[model samples]
Every structure is written in C-alpha cells, then in structure tokens.
Target: MSGQLFVIGLGPGNASQVTPEASHAVAEAEFFFGYGPYVDRLELRPDQTRIASDNREELSRANAALQRAAEGAKVAVVSGGDPGVFAMAAAVCEAIEKGPVEWRDIDLTIIPGVTAMLAVAARIGAPLGHDFCTISLSDNLKPWAVIERRLEAAASAGFVIALYNPISKARPWQLGSAFEILRRHLPGDTPVIFGRAAGRPDERIEIVKLEQADPAKADMATCVMIGSPETSIVERAHKPPLVYTPRFSTESSQ
Candidate 1:
C-alpha cells in the first residue's frame, strides 16, 4: 500500500492556535520530520519516530520525509506557522517535482495553520484590513538586490507590508536597509509594529512610528509590520492603542 506524506503547519507557538485538521494530521503520522525546534514541540505518540534537523536543512528534511513515505511510513513534515507561508510546504513540493516518477504516487496533503503575520495582526488590530503583501528580509536563498526591489515596489504601491525573517546575527543590516527604502516613500510618522515571538511566553507587541522603529529591536523571532498610507491609529482611555487600515479605498470614491 502507498503511504502518505502530510506537510503540517504548527501555527505560531501556542497549541490552541493550531487547527483541528493539522492536529489530527500530526497525530496520524507514524514519522515526523522537521527542524529540531519545531519537531521538539510536537506531542509524539510512542509509536512514532522523529527526524529532526537544523533550521537551514529544509530541503534535506523534506527529502527524508519523502523517502520514508516511499518506504510505506506515514510521514509528517512540520513547519512553524503555516507550512505554505515561507515554510516546509514549498520545499516538499519542490522535492516531489524533482524526485522520480514513483514519488508522485505518494499521498501528499498540506495542512494550513495560523501564519505569524495574521496572528500578529490579530493581537494588535486589523492593520491588514486593506491591501497588503508579505516579504522575507532574509537573503539566504535569494539575493539582497531582489529583496530590495520588492521592498521598494511594495512601498511605492502603498501596501501594508509584513516582514518575516527580519533579522539575525548574520543578516543584521537588512532590516535597517529595508526601513530606509520604506522611508523614501512613506512619512516618518507612519505606524510600525514589532511583534516578537507572538503567542509565546515572552511575546511582546511594540507599536512605534517609522522614525522610531529601530532595527535593533528585531531578531529572527520578530515580525515587523509597516502600515500603508491608509492605515490609522485609534487610542482609547485605559486601553492599548489600535492600528488598522480602512477597508474602503479613496480610489473607488473618486
């Protein structure tokens, strides 16, 4: 009998945020494969085996899961947040595309979860109520030039931007460079949010103006969100401030 491969998204870090389908998929799998930290989060059954690897070994991890499925082991390749959103789903699909014809016979399912951007938006307000785009500031897989172009284009288009993989020890300067590009098109007082480790114990949400959004406040665990021109803030007495983009567009009103 042919075995199955489930690419599951663990959501942020909170177990409650995970979808029922994704949880079921994790429970059903006989073998789990993922980056070590993500794999460590799962509540594995006694009958299950885990294949954990370093964060950068996505392709190899996907391949190993595929190999296990081909050998009749039900496998789950897990990712943090939504697997399809800058995670293992794409890597698994790419592996299947490049593998042998027999690889096509494996049952593959992509289980979605609450992506970090959306979770962060929910915790703050609906900053993404209007048009928006997501970008990864990491240049590990793509060139910095390509990332720069996308950042400039997004800023020019006035799209509320959600930045993933914003900064790390090796890529410390990219977030600063991206902010500089945004400053060229956006006002200095525009709203920006630094949502770090959302849903985790150390989770923090910092709201600041673009001028105050220092890249030093971010790390690999942070998701930086920049508001579009249409975005606005509403303050309440004894309540945290709310930031949101208006649903209606001025273009339609004209």
Candidate 2:
C-alpha cells in the first residue's frame, strides 16, 4: 500500500503560527523533504530521514517526496508558508498530473499554515480586510512582461496588493520596477508596507508612501503590501500606526 504524503506549510518560521493539524501531520511522517532551511527548522525524530535541498529545487523536492510515499514511506513536504501559495502544493499537484499514472492513487493531504502575507497583514493591522491580490515579483518562473501587466492590472483594479519574493540577490531591481509601474496607476502617497522576517526574531515592519518605497530596503524575506486608494492609516501616540483597507468602497449610512 502507498503511504500518505502531506504538504505542510510552516508559517513564517514561527512555532506559534503553525497550525495544530500541521503539527500532527509532521508527527505522523517518517520522512520529510523540503528546502534546507525549512527542513532544518523541524524537530525531527531520530527515525525520521531529512531530505534537504537548496532553494529553487522545488520540483525535484516534490518528486522526491512523492516517490518515497509511493514506496510506502509516510512523508511530509514542507514549505515556508501556506504550501498552496507559490509553494510545494502546486508543484506536487503538477507533478502528480504529469508523472506516472499510479502516482494518482497515492494519498495526499495539504496542511495549511499562516501565509507570510497574512501574518504580515495582522502585524500591520487589517490591510487585507477587503479585496486583495498576491503577486510574486520573481521573474524566474514567468516573463517580466507578464509581471508588469499583472501589476498594472492590479493597480488599475484598486486591489490591496501583497507581493511575495519581492527582491533577491539575483533580481534586486524587480521591486523598484514594480513600484514604478504601480505608481503610474496608484497615487504617489498611497500606503506601502514592507514586512521583513515577519514573525521571526529579526522581524521588521516599515510603512511608507508608494513614492517613498525604497527597493534597497527589501530582500527575498520581505513581503510588500500596497494599500488601495481607500486604505487608511490611524496614528497613535505610543504605538505603531495601524493600516487597514475598509470593507466597503465608500461609507454607508446607518
């Protein structure tokens, strides 16, 4: 019999953010496969085998997990955030669809966790209270033109935008390029949030205007949230400002 495969999201690299269901899934696994950092984060049992790979090997990692599961090994494939969001879940799905026919019968479960954008949003207030869209700024998978078109479309649609994989060593200028496109459709003073290492010890949150967003401050660990025109910021005397996008486009009468 084929063993089960669980694609678990280890939310924002914090113990508290991981769901109990995800914990249980981990406990049940005899083998774990994931990016090296995420694999290192787990408290592995003595009997569990750890399959760690460097970044950008998502497809290979997913195949490894699936093959082991097919061999009757209870396996867990870990992703940094909710696996469905630009993580292992999609890769696993695609692999199953394209791989050997028997792979389809293998039991699979995806355990969700707190995605980075949601964790960052909570820390900054309710910037995602209304309609929102997420986009990855990495051009490694798709063409830069596609990203620009999506940015323009999201800006024109006035959706709260949460950007993932905003900047990295190899693609440092994408964030700045994104801001340039967005500013054409969004106001110069629109609220932009930079949440770095959101739930970890070195977490940092910065609020800035669209025109003032410095791409230099961003890295791969950061998630950038850009508020819609209706988004509001509330200042407090002794606390960080609260940023939120309202549920309604305009005020409603009582």
Candidate 3:
C-alpha cells in the first residue's frame, strides 16, 4: 500500500514558526526530503530518513522521495516557506507526473506556511499594500533578457516590486541590473528594503535609498522589497523604525 506524501512548509528560519500540524507531519513521515540547510534545522530523529543536498541535487532528491513514497514509505517533502510559494511543492508535483511514481493512490498534501514575501512586506510597513508584482531577478532558470523586459514593464506600470532570488554568491550583478531598470522609471529616492537571513541567525533588515541597494549584502536567503512612490519611513523614539506605502491617499491626487 503506497502511503501518504506531504509537501510541508517549514517557514522562514525560526523553528518556532513551524506549525504544530507541520511538526506532526514530520514526525509521522518515514522520510523527510528537503534542502540541505533545512534538513539541518530539525533535530535528528534516528527512525526518520533524511534526503538532503545542494540545490543542484533537488531534482534527484525529489525523485528519490517520490520513489520511496511509491514504495509505500510515508514521505514528507519539506521546503522553507510555503511549499507552493517559490518552493519545492511544484517540483514534487512535476516529478510525479514524469516519473514512474503512481500518484493515483499516493495521497499528496501541500501544507502552507509563512512566506518571506509577506514577512518582508510587513517589516517595511506596507509597500505591498498597493498593487504589486513579484519577480525573481535570477537568470539560472530563466533568461536574463526576459527578466529585464519584465522589470521594465513593471516599473513603467507603477507596480511595487517584490524581487525574489535577487542575488547570490555566484550571480552578484543581477540585482544591480534590475535596479538600473527600475531607476529608469522609478524615482531615485524610492525606498528599498533588503532582508538578509530573515528570521534566522545573522538576520539583518535595513532600508536604503533605491540607488544604494548593494548586491554584496544579498544571498539566496535574502528577499528584496522595492517600494512604489507611496512608501515612506516614519520616525520613532529618536530613530526611524517604520515604513508605510498606502494604497491610495488624497495627498497623491494633488
């Protein structure tokens, strides 16, 4: 009897953010398949199998997990943030379609969790409160020229940009290029917030002038939030601790 397969979301970085249902799913699974760093977060359970590796091995790892499930092992394919939100859920779904795995009987569930996009938006007050669009600046899976076109369109249309996969160890200039596209259509003083290792150790969240967003501070773990003209930072206690971009205000009509 092929057992159930779960695609569970682990949330950003904090274990505390893990839902009780997610913990239960993890405990019940005979195998936990996830990114290498995510697997390290859970305390080692001897009876539970772990399939973890670098991002390059994700396809293979996902295939192995599906194979195990086909063989009737209860498997949990884990991802940081909502599995369906720029995570491994789609991989598991696509692999099942192409592989020999029998999905007809294998119960598959995608459990949702807090995504970095929403968290970063909250930290910056409400840049996302208005109409916004999300785009990944990475070219590894998608072409760079396509990304440039989309960036241009989004900026021209006045949509706040939530850029994922903004930068990493190898592709450093992607974000800079994206910024350049935005600068052509967006105001230079527009607010941009960079969230580094958000909710994790070495966490650093800072707001900077749009022109000053450094690519060096980013990695695969970071999420970049670019505000529309409406975003503004407010002062708090002797410091500016807040930002907000209202969807619409009478002030903009003048």
Candidate 4:
C-alpha cells in the first residue's frame, strides 16, 4: 500500500498552464501539498486532502508530505512555476536526503511546468532569444556572497538574467543589491521587466529602465527580468513594448 509522491508544478498562476501530466498526477492523488497562494489555483475534487502553508514553512511542509506518502497516502507536493526551478523539488529532495523519514523506497517524481521566466519572456517578445540564465536573489538558502558572484559572472558572460524571488517583505534590498552589481556590466538603459503574478488576474508587466527597477514594487510573487547588452526596446507606433535580443544569425559582425 505504498503511495507515490509527486512534486507537481502548477505553472505561473492560471489553471490553463497546468500540464496534462501534472493534472493527471493531482487527479490520482489522495493528498496534496503546496504554498497557500498556489493552493487556490486548483479546482480539485472534495476527496483530495490538501496541506497549504507559506514559503517560510515550505521545507517542513514538503517533509510532512513525504511522511504522509510513507504512511500509505497517495500524495502530490505542489509548487507554482516550475518545481525544479527555484521551487519545492530541491527542498523535497534535500529533505529526503537528510533521512528525516526512514523510508527510502518511496516513489518520487518531479513533474515540470512552464515557468514565469519563459512566460515573461514571451510577453516581452523573446528577450531570451539568445543565451540566458536564471538566479534567485534570496540569501535564505544560499550565501549572498555566492549569489553576487553568480550575478557578476552572468553579467560578464552577457547572459540575460531571469531573477526569481527578487524581493519580499523581509528581504527588500536583495534585488537592489544584485542590480547594482549587474549595472557595472550592463548599461543602465538595458530593459528590465517587473512581472507580478505572471498569468494571474492581477498580473502586471511593467517595462522599466535598469536604473529605475524599483524593488519597492516587488514581492515574492514577482519575477524581475533583466536583459543583456544587446537587448533592444523596440516601440512600434501602436503596438505595446517589444523586447528583442539578437540571435547569432541576427547579429552582424563588423
């Protein structure tokens, strides 16, 4: 009667982004777990038991989910955006690695979904056309010094940044700190997008200059995208803001 544990990704905000695999995984689950905000994203049947909590308690919640699975409850541990990308997958893995639950034979799977980085990239018209990398500015998991080194490396390497977990109530200055470091490599005119709750009802996309990317307007639900040096802000006469990053073919060598 051993049950399977699924780290299901719910995508950004809308139920429309939910993958068929993820949907099927949830449909088969007897129990579910995820962040409080993302729990509201689903329309599950009444029989499915759900565990919801804030980001601060994500690890504890995930551990409890695994424990439930070990106790023979079919389970799904949910996460918004992509589970493997700055979400609950790693946390679940780490918890399992720590041997908190003595059961080592439990079934575990990581289901992928569309992330906010790709969603925002689509909204801004291929700012990720070339090379790019994603990094979270939060120092809670990793050292701030290590994150700074990554930011500097990404900047010098000309990799466009898809910054997750940019700012929150407690870590208000994290984004600003990374931006200050990136500005040294990227020009101040580079396009920076503030995407709030991407794919949700209150979703907002603000295109601001690098110098004016205000961290005050950001929170855990937000994803801040900073483009590379070649990233262009092309404005058509009537169309909305369009971001274009040159590909190898598009770039003309002198």
lDDT of each: 0.92, 0.93, 0.81, 0.86
Q: Evaluate residue 33 in candidate 2 and report its C-alpha lDDT on the 0 to 100 scale.
A: 95
- Please provide the root mean square deviation of candidate 1 (C-alpha atoms, Å): 1.2
Give one digit per residue, the lDDT tens place, for model 3 in 99-139.
Answer: 77366568888888877887776655676877888897878
Model 4 regions more than 4 Å off? 100-102, 249-254
Question: Against the true structure, what is each candidate's TM-score?
Answer: 0.98, 0.97, 0.92, 0.92
What local lDDT score does residue 133 receive in model 3, on the 0 to 100 scale? Answer: 87
lDDT of 1 at 90: 94
> Per-residue lDDT for 1-254 in model 2, tens only?
79899999999998999999999999999999999999999998899899999889988888888999999989999999899999999999988998888789999999998999999999999999999999999888999999999999999988999999999888888999999999999988899999999889999999999999999988889999999998999999999999999888873353
RMSD to truth, every model = 1.2, 2.2, 2.3, 2.2
Query: Order the candidates by TM-score, highest first — what do you get?
Result: 1, 2, 4, 3
Which candidate do you rate higher for lDDT, 1 or 3?
1
Q: Lowest summed lDDT over 10 consecutive residues: which window, candidate 4?
A: 245-254
Candidate 2 vs candidate 3, TM-score winner: 2
Clashing pairs in 2: none
